[model samples]
Target: MRVTIVMAALAVLATAAFAQDSPSADNGKVVFDKWCTPCHGAVAPPEMPFGGDGLPGTSALGVKYRGELPAVLEERTDLAPEFIETVVRGGLFGMPITRKTEVSESELEDVIAYLTRNNN
Candidate 1:
């Protein structure tokens, strides 16, 4: 009985360690919603106080890809973690660069994990 109890405890500890090593999509979703959703969401209500603008990034991507790829980043399968990190940090065209203050390193990793969750 004591041996069995010791094995159970070890199993629990192992599971906890594995979980910490993995990136969380839920946390990534929160980061994406807070930062990228404003410009990249599929839809934005026109009733918003910020003038109800449509998704600029989505629109631009649609025009650029011409339906060959998904306009929404999350729906896209061709994205690489490196590309996402570069664009987020360096900005592209009309997009503004995200500073470390706005997005920490760990938060960026979460966002990358969230966006690339389907790649695997």
Candidate 2:
């Protein structure tokens, strides 16, 4: 079990190492708007009040939640970048992993930056 954890951590570090190498925030922005924007918004179910106006390709969660559905993530300011990347790569039960193909490395970083911004 310990070895598994270490291996996973190493793998995550490697991926993040490469992610840091990606130097295109513009590409990241595009990737975010396309994929991450659907479920990682700031509003909740009742507040934003999704009117069920989903067209094709829209996420089912988006219909019920906001674009920033993972509200708790916003609160975790001290969280590790690698942890966030892993969660995004291998999604939670309610969330789907945003594959590298779906979003470029820079794009993922940009989305993380955008989400972590202190707009509040």
Candidate 3:
């Protein structure tokens, strides 16, 4: 167990080092489309209240934010890098934790860049 923990820590450190490279928001959009769009996609006008029958994340956020914030992930501009990193890595409410294998540290960094591109 100790060895496993140490190995995991080292792997995280290594990935952190690799994530330092400049991330591309364009590439992040691709990753987001592939991985996050299914649950977090835009809701049509007809689906405004519930996000249709497929977009649970969007619908949930719609209910959670009550219009104070955009439910569509792409439209949100208040995301912070640290918050994104924590939520993506540890999950939040109904969102599942994304493993490094699923979205490598580099990919996560890129996603952050893409999501925060419109931030002030």
Alpha-carbon lDDT of model 3: 0.88
TM values, all candidates: 0.82, 0.45, 0.74
Instruction: Show where candidate 3 strays beyond 4 Å.
Output: 1-20, 43-53
Candidate 2: regions farther than 4 A off: 1-30, 43-76, 117-120
- Report the C-alpha lDDT of model 2 over 1-120, residue by residue, as the tens digit: 999999999999999987777545465456656775456534434432345332212335454446555234444345456776887898866677777787757667776665455434
lDDT of 1: 0.87
Shift in Å, residue 44, candidate 2: 5.1
lDDT of 3 by residue, 1-120 (tens): 999999999999999976667798999999999899988888543554534546888877878898999999899999999998999999998899999999999999999999999987
Best-matching candidate per TM-score = 1
Candidate 1's TM-score = 0.82
lDDT of each: 0.87, 0.59, 0.88
Worst-scoring 10-residue span by lDDT in model 2? 48-57
Better of 2 and 3 by lDDT: 3
Give the C-alpha miss distance for residue 8 in model 1, angstroms: 2.1
